[model samples]
Target: MSNPKIFVARLLGLDVFDPLGDRLGRLRDVVVVDRGLHQPPIATGLVIEVPGKKRVFVPMTRVTSMDSGQILTTGLINLRRFSRRGAEQTVAGDLFDRRMVLVDEEGRLEHEHESVLEDLAIERQRNGDWIVTEVYVREVTGRGAFGRARGQHRLVDWDRSRWARGTEPQGATSFVAAHEDLKPADLADMLHDMTDKRRVEVANELQDERLADVLQELPDDDQVQILSHLDIERAADVLEEMDPDDAADLLGELPDNQQELLLELMEPEDAEDVRRLLEYEEDTAGSVMTPVPVIMAPEATVAEAMATIRQTEISPARASLVIVARPPLETPTGRYLGVVHFQKLLRYPPPEPLGNLLDKDLEPVSDLAPVTHVTRELATYNLTCIPVVNEQQRVVGAVTVDDVLDHILPEDWRAMDPDQTPAPSTENPAPTAGGPASARGGAPAAPAAGPTTNRRT
Candidate 1:
């Protein structure tokens, strides 16, 4: 019942428990996630060793906390419930599980970059052997060259394929499909055409990222189908590579059950982000702002701001609009103090303090405030997007309308912009740290950045 305390090292070899306090397995490894901003880490999933040497899987849900010399389980797990990936899923023997992982070595879903094996590739090796089949690689694997050896189908072995069902491309009566391929390009296009179907019939397919990109440009409905159809982990990798907001929006359209399934399947933070946006009304700023913003202290130099932004993993903080704030943001009102459009920040001497060039009269709003107030005030000031302040006046979040139309009122409601707070904005999606950013009622808000912590590789 008390807060569980354990050493990070204990995570390596400690025995893990289920919610029932029953011994489920020994901890095989730890999954570390990197959030661009400083947020607590999440254990994507666990590599567990159950009793009788019957190894099975246990996800974070079955975990309670990491304790000294042990892992607290949810007391609800039984190793019999799930199957674990064994030795065949290795990089040297199993390339299928190695491709999607950015970190971690044994096919555990930890981060986006580490999915090495899911969505396997099909290319002619100079030796004349082709890598036509693969299992969905685990999210974690140590560095090493990987390629599944030739077998009956000449690619993925059935033993591996059964376990990596969703990770590999489906269909085809035989391996001859990819082997007799017209061309990778034509195959890519052909699969794209049937992407909308419940099942795609392809003997050989394009690699994961390439296939994901082609699917992205298709209609929204199509993208969802293809994404959902991929192995859970590989699908997660594609989503991880995508803009969080866009991924969040797309996931929101799915059924609640499916939503949870996909979230459980993804790396923890990515799932949390999607769920976070799902909390806001699809049309509100809460749904639009990427949780990771690059905020700087008003007192800091532009150079400091640049350093912080560059450290970010995905979106570069330096080249975008950077809002000035206090360090470790103590309050919401603190965020509204100033703004420095990216252009203006670059024009000033890097050594100069950001406060020197900031537009100090920052406009902010309570997240719960009517969207109408935001639309009107921003329109009057010719502001692109405004910050959302909390009751304490600390800036918590911002909103935009680049994708969501609900944030922007239709022509019929444009006249009502300046009116008192519109009650309709209160249709609660979820509670946001910053209310929501103002929507686009007229002109667009500046497509700038904030000081949220997100990392891009």
Candidate 2:
């Protein structure tokens, strides 16, 4: 087959084999060395992830052939673990998703302009080494008219654009899309495993909403570490994007002074909810319930309710039931009427008003309800979430089954790698019983989160 220009995204994860056809490992990265300002970087070797351990490298000179099927090596692989030298750059690991500047053909950068390294255009040279000649750069621009803004991609000569200075990468969304399917929890766990400096690098790239979701999944220490790296204003913005309960839990991990500082910097409405959550005992229903959920008026039509759900971007657990209340759907929800479950909405016509379908008899738990009682109530009703109300039956928030599990399960439960099957927990039966409750609507929704890097392409 003729040599085709390949992208870094296409090269990663391909199978590698020896000349004898022995299966070795999957291709992990492409090592390259910059030649000079005139010539683009030249591929030096390939980094491969071995069967069960560290990544290793093989010089391009050892390869007998390279193709989509697999890389046939000369069988002279260097078994030494691959550690990047100061001058070396690896395609997938270092440059694939780096946020960069878009310099026009005249070499001038647009004001506040941003772009990301989508892929590298690698072509084979006569000397047998593949070299990067151009980059697939994607510009972040406003979408035409009504649609959401996004990346506009095109290939460009490598030397035209300079690396963006001091800005965090704008590549997390595209990077996640380029990689295999990833959940927020998975990405958060990966961030936790990285060093603090590395975590900051990745954290800087994510949008506040995505970062908030990942912060919710991470351990308290990791959450605090990431927040510390962000400016107070940005940190507060991220906290506002998070579920109030999750935000409260994270803020609780910080010293009183730091917590107050961030809260002061936050939008008052968002801060009030988190502050209210902080007031409750850690193990109580009030503390665990999310302050933000879909709350609709009893007279809301199914279509209206659906529209509200769409606008909120809430999780399935939060969306499974539309809390019907007396007007003023905001926090301290006016007299709670009942709930219209999502399943019931599907059964009724879209124009049907929720007031008629409200399950008025379903009792709302008090803010003081303990975790044990809360879990039992969820199990008894087969509910993904249950509303918590005050003395006058005003809805405060809803506690999802996952929140209960987070409190009951071992502190390190989320830290465990997903690929490794966890041993059955011998201690608690609450999570075991509540697990199915949380998974009521097929798989629980992944925490909506997203990560990025320095100028590299």
Candidate 3:
């Protein structure tokens, strides 16, 4: 077998196959046994997420070929579930994203400067032991994009890095980068599977806007947990970035004092919107409606309304209808005139006024109306969103179908499905042909004669 040095990050999610070409599972993580201070940890095995999402361990020796998208393993396999043991850590779950100190070649600390672990390169030695050899890291230079630090990214010898003191919190710079392409909901699901400590660490590292988006998709309990762990000032900042209605919902779960403190710390404009929603009873139109819906004046052109809806920041539900109201286009406008469906705008000329296309027959719902009433109105009109009005008949906001569904669903609807597999065993089981014993107890057997090649992948 060739000895290619591969970054652990690149190995994650790669398909794992047996010698007979039978699909087995996907590579989830690399398990390594720490070899103390300056020595690279020996790569002991691979954590494979098999069918049913059950993660099992495949000792390194069992791996026959590892390339770009997949790994070929010898047929000899252990079906027992994989669990962490003394001195053993999984690269993806435990090491990547950790804060570490940079050290010089002489092992002298580099002014205590900090860096985050982004990836680890591992290679099989002549003796057939696979070990971590290089560390890819990003320097921590304070907050930058999305509140995460930005600085030089470098790959250094494994021995040049030292784990930060245990007292310090771990960093999530690399973790967030690795998953940056994931959708907010998918990211939320990923966060749900992590330990609370790691979840909070990642949340704190995320930018306010990004974290706010993720919070909106997470379960209410998760939202509160992540928020409670953030700094008060940052918590307020993140809340401001969230949709007003969602922010209010999250704040409602906190103690009055804590909620009030965060709200007070928020920008006045943002806080005012959230405070308005907080005043309404839960399950009411006003409580779930977004105050910052797309609103336009009676004289606004169809083209203008179309342009407004095209904005990327506006959600589909909010863009489905253009609220044509009296002067003062902002929420709580002069009066609730009517709404123009997006389809209607498409039929009219760009120069045509939105006022002429208003669906005057559609009655608006009162802010105080129950969610059931709002739902009936939306269903009867076949509308994605309906105008919400105050006692004075002024448009205050709009209740979207999504908001209705959120309220109607079970309280635990946002919770992730629990894994059906039993908890992984904590005890280290006996070693098999290519198990931990090679790294922990004694030298691994000699590798099968083959051309030796070492290249970073």
Candidate 4:
């Protein structure tokens, strides 16, 4: 199968494509309904930009096919005279809102496309027509877009061998379409939508890598629950799927019982990685970074680097922090050079020496250092990520702005205080029978109005 042609609307940073090769306006944003009643989410139309004339707002419903370079629409809408709305943010922005398929590293979906994960699985029923199944795990007390997807489904029948164990994959490049009912992208959306309870249920049922992707997008609470739901053997399989820092972060949030359970569930290598990350505090650079990094010896060839990247897992942080070090030191010192971006590395000649590509005049920080330093550096450079190094210059980890935002923002961001900060709950529960209301807390029970038995009509 050919790769699903995906169009990165370069002009607008929006992704739009039709399977049938039609041009549609970029997807600007989506409205999700996670906390309200009867009304479903209303998808916003997009403004298709034209060269000289006016732009038009094309309703997403007009989309007939979504594949590769363009989005096929039901009918052409002349958007030449279109007006702009405030919701036309980039697709990256929409992905971080926590309520849609498009999500950011912080586990929030910025866009809320109601149609995401709306798979058309063809379940054969002995007849010609196939069963169109929408695969999702339902939940009670769930929040976010998860309200629409809550239930226990093992997805036991999926072809695991197709997704893994392949030298050259045979199905769709996206492979998302291979499953009649599920797609990685759609499942990615469900990862953000599921409740802690339901997420755990789904986590236990998927492949480790698949589960890892979902868990990576979940909050601490949900991460713990999902990990808890899996047996140690199965949980370990998924644990290996995540980046070390993420695995550490989730394990750190689990109760003692669950933490131990997950650790035991993990393989020695994965367990060791988490152990290393857990060695530091949540606010520390060490805790937030993965000790496992892509380090290059100064003598290595650029071709070797390319081969390595293709072989190992690469994270957003890793893409930004490619450390070049002298072989003598496990951790490069003043000898340690600055980081080179993945693009730069890829662009360099394959035969170039690592030393030639190393940027020596770089700032380095200790893993034990505060995250604020990383944040400050990122702010100064306008970088999405920064690198952490030891005193000897050995690269220890990379810090991402997304993770920084996660660290700064509280879980219940809705309950902000007067200062626009998350405030502590001011409510106090009512006292039980015979318990003094005043003593039970809450504005001193209005001073109890002692001896107020006087009947002054």
User: Which prediction has more favorable TM-score, 2 or 3?
Assistant: 3
Against the hidden reference, what TM-scores do the models get?
0.44, 0.56, 0.57, 0.48
| Tens-digit lDDT string for candidate 2 (52-134) | 55578888777666665577777887655565542466777677656678666676875466777767766677766678877
Worst 10 residues of 4 by lDDT: 442-451
Model 3 pairs whose backbones collide? 146-207
Instruction: Name the best candidate (by TM-score).
Output: 3
Q: What lDDT tens digits, residue by residue, belong to model 1 across residues 1-457?
A: 2323222222445677655667666765433322212232233455566765543545555555554445776665443322211111212122323232222244343333333333332222344322322233433334445643221112232123222234432344232233343443344345545534422333113334444445434445656767766666556666665566667766876788877777887668767766766776644445565555556677888787767656646344223656677766532324356777766767888899887888866555555555555555566676555665555556655544333334553423322444645454444443344533322111100111211112110
> Lowest-lDDT window of 10 residues in candidate 2?
442-451
The true-versus-predicted C-alpha distance at residue 360 of model 4, in Å, is 1.8
Measure candidate 3: CA RMSD.
Answer: 23.0
lDDT, model 2, position 415: 70
Better of 3 and 4 by lDDT: 3
* lDDT value, residue 28 of candidate 3: 89
Q: By TM-score, highest first, what's the ranking?
A: 3, 2, 4, 1
- Candidate 3: global Cα-lDDT? 0.79
Scored against the true structure, residue 22 in model 4 reaches a CA lDDT of 49
lDDT of 2: 0.74
* Over 4 Å off, model 3: 1-171, 416-457
lDDT ranking, best first: 3, 2, 4, 1
Residue 160 Cα positional deviation in candidate 3, in Å, after optimal superposition: 12
Query: For residues 262-377, could you state the per-residue lDDT of candidate 4 as single tens digits?
Result: 78756676687688778776676777866656677778888877776675466565556566755543322235565666777778898988777766555655676656555665
Q: How displaced is residue 282 in candidate 4, in Å?
A: 2.2
